[model samples]
Target: MEKKPFFQGLTKKTIALALAVILWAFTNFELDVERDVRIPLHLSGLPEDLIIVNNAPENVDLSLRGARNLLSSFAFSNKSIPVDLQKTERGVLKIDLKRAASQIVPRGIDIVAARPSKLSLNIDMLVTKRFKVKPVLGEPDSGYEISKKLKIVPQFVKVKGPASQLGKLESIETAKIKLEGEKAEFTAPVQLQLPSQYMEVLEGDHVNVTVYIKEIILSKEFRDVDIVPRNFGELEYTTTPELKATLVFNGPYKTINDLTSNDVKVFIDGAEMGESRVKRLRVKVQYPNSDLLKLTKTSPTSVRVRVKPPPPEESPET
Candidate 1:
């Protein structure tokens, strides 16, 4: 009785320690703790032909309550709440967050509340359209002009976006490419201007633009070109000073250099001066390939012409 076995004492102490641990665990499990956690909001079951045009919530604020011990060891990483839209149509969709909280929260945690009880989403039908790519270029250097039409590789782009927005879009423009003080032909890689955050160029985001520039040459002048009368009926017409003028025109070097007075016709319309003896008429210029040349100047813009009835035909052998 006076001396106890060492092994017996050790056994009793172990039992007591075991009991204490069990009691501590029981108490901790009964106590509740609250925590506010941020969980990512995931979208699911969206139709392939639909898109969300409006900004949707990225994360949800969740208030969770659970046993103290469970709360202490809880991890919030990679947890998400999903909003299903499989059967949702194009319109404003209101989602009840409370209903979805149970599906995402950890097993032991209870959802106390969600900051936003409801979420509103704006959905639209997705569509694709072809849009012409327009190059945005700054003014070229002085005395220079764009000689030929700009050439864009992949002139058209396929764009995808919400149907409502895509319907209004006709063309996409490239970012401003500065041609100020630029001369000669050059190419540049430029990004397309996006219509909105919801719209994207499905083909590509960038394009290569080839610009053709040429120095503006001085206009070539053809002097002493004869002016003729046209649309004359049974009348004779004559102009003062024999109706001659100088013509000035600008065009490609080859085209303008090869042009001659015979290639151009300066005329006055006789029909426009009906029954008038003396009339002032405007001079008009014409050429076989008129589109190639730009008329810059003309001397004697108007001509004074005298119109008279043709002399009575001489009676033959009465």
Candidate 2:
């Protein structure tokens, strides 16, 4: 019986295999390596009374140095840097990003360097403010008008946002409501338009808006309206002044805009004249659609009329 040597069968092939394994270990596990890894930045512990107004980095780049295997595993792992803002106050805050990077680093891996070693943050106080709700509207049909007094169910709304931003806000407008071809009053539910991205509607997000629509009223002046003499016989007669009148008409927009001087008439009634050679005659006006149209004013409301005396031609002819 014989005892086998501890290094029995140590051939050239075996020696080469051992060396290859050792080199792989040094390259992957024992030797130190550097790598740049990007990890998410988690923000927590922020005071409820404060808000961040500036653009903050969502992820930070970390230069890590450690064994190749460890760093590779850590880089691929789901890990984030947790930032605690429990002691933060309203204003600009400078943060040490290196400290944050070191906190979440694994036990073996070392943080060689961190991009953006510091962060400049803009903070503001959280506040609630009330603002008037302005209703937005589109153009109505032609010859129609919308009332100036818009009825909103909740006239005012309360919003919570950064104090600095809220200071510049005047009024919040509602989602645009179209009044195109609208002929009558209507009520609709409308969403509000937030002025700032950081603002949240705490009281009223949607409101009921009552829009009033009516036919537009307009005034038109008809110049140089003819004033004719009515019931005047063949006898010669003359008026104190050239018979011309001006009229101002008030009515619906469509009717007034379409009306013309020909649609109206003015006349002096000679039948109502007295025996006086010279007499004052009152002028009268007439027009179609009087129910919807009204004659607001008439220039030269009265005129003087004279009857010419006939010549004594009968005695001369005889």
Candidate 3:
């Protein structure tokens, strides 16, 4: 073997080499540092649905650890790493380090800051209301039937946002709640998908809507019979919802449609019918003008008329 001193010197050189390599690695590597960030004020980029009343971690502390050269040049004041409020809403927006990063940041540095150092975003006032929702349809495949009726859970909901945006928002709707004429039920979120520039919707993610479907039936018939005045004396001419009596009919659906309401009529006979009394009764049908499904049945198929006696000869001359 070679002399011991020679090996010892070689061993020392080897150790030095390893330490130099390790130091180089540390110089190349970066450590996370906490940075304090501050935003001047709310900007115009925020969404209408969200009111960024406060900034999260108002004063953000980001941890950055990187090459000494890079760290030496890094300064929190150099650039504006804004707290993007355009997409934020009235609710709390947690700090997102992924975006807090800037071009100056190197790969080695890490982000380590207070969970929420500063902020008291005061979201503006928002008001929501109930609105009518209409459904639209697209061409559907053959043979399937869709339910025409739509059921809105809670029927309505409230939407709150900036007054300006709220005014333009005539409605909050979904992506066409369509069943494609498949004759089934449909449920989805009431996604108020606004343009990118628009504010984020802080309301619940989805709305509850229900639709029922049933096969169409074509076997019913209907008819209209003349309406007769009822208790006319009891009603003053000015009274609203004038009361009327009419003959109610029930029979073959086809036959009912074949007859007209005018064809059925109620008339009074002059056979010395007593006052406050009526006798002539008949059924007359006439042309129809409405689509009230069917007049399945009528109440008081008949009526008893009472006539008030002539006022006793006006009280003797004053």
Candidate 4:
């Protein structure tokens, strides 16, 4: 009986040893390293879409926790299986639990939790477009009109969002100013919108828009626009006094360009301009400033002012 008991004990020990060895082998067989890796998968080159969301998806959150080894071997794809479009409607997007490609797929992972589980994807057909963000002005003070150069900053911007949503956005407008004859720098915080839908402005939203107004000079009437003379003294000529000079003046276009030979009256110290031949002056009219209407012309060239006294009275009746 003692011997039988001994044999039974041996069998029990063998069973226990075998169980321990099997457990040890299993424990040491594989690397038990797990990691939360972000993997990207292709969205099956279905058409190009540019729809951005205000929030992140849930499945995207859940798929992050995965085994490092498996994730390392996963493939990255921008395109994948065609998503289920049957239930897809405007402002709705449902993530394909199975179809969507991911960079990492855990070898033996059970999805603990999924975000946007059935992503009610507001299926926005995405589109990126370039637009001109121009400024609009309100009625200016009486007699003062707005200029074309009054454009806003960020002259151009890129817009992105659902196709239907983006298509509706035609133009963006800023605050209006009642320009009251002043050089003022104006700024405003503005919002963007479409015909009926709102815009997800990718580049611009609240920007510092500026408006500048130039004061116009209406009461500044012009006169004959005198010709300031040149002083050359103590130089004598044999036959006649030669006073060669150039004339420069600034005035209105009509008065300058319309100047004919009859308009010019030249005389030395207010004399009858004896033998003074008035050459046809060439006038070049120019707008002096971006603000004022003060035009100036340097002439086609310098006007040669010659002073030759009366031709010796022709030696009459000798």
Top candidate, metric lDDT: 2
Tens digits of lDDT, candidate 3, 64-86: 54556556666656554466566
RMSD of each: 13.6, 4.4, 18.6, 14.7
lDDT tens digits, residue span 48-127, model 2: 99999888888889888889888777644588888888999988988888788887787888888888778888889999
Q: Which residue runs of candidate 3 sit more than 4 Å off their true CA positions? A: 1-140, 143-147, 184-203, 214-318
TM-score of each: 0.59, 0.78, 0.30, 0.33
lDDT of 1 by residue, 1-318 (tens): 566676668978999999999999886786577889888888999999999888877888988888877877766776788888899899989888977867866678898898788888889999999999999989988667898999898899999999999898779999998988777999989999987999988977999999999877656899999888788766776778668888899886557777888889998888889678998899999975677788988888988878766678888996
Task: Give the per-residue lDDT digits (tens) of candidate 4, residues 1-318.
Answer: 246665768978999999999787655443453434333322333334534333433224344434444434545333232343544444655575533433234355434443434444445666777777756557556444444465466776777666675566666555454455544455565554433343456775644556654333342323433333323243232322333323344333334444443444332332322334543233323223323333332322333444444465665696
Better of 2 and 3 by TM-score: 2
Instruction: Score residue 282 of candidate 1 by CA lDDT.
Output: 95
Which scores better on TM-score, 3 or 4? 4
**Per-residue lDDT of 79 in model 2:** 81
Clashing pairs in 2: none
Ranked by lDDT, the better of candidates 1 and 3 is 1
How would the candidate models be sorted by lDDT, starting from the highest? 2, 1, 3, 4
lDDT of each: 0.85, 0.87, 0.47, 0.46
The alpha-carbon deviation from the true structure for residue 299 of candidate 1, after best TM-score superposition, in angstroms, is: 11
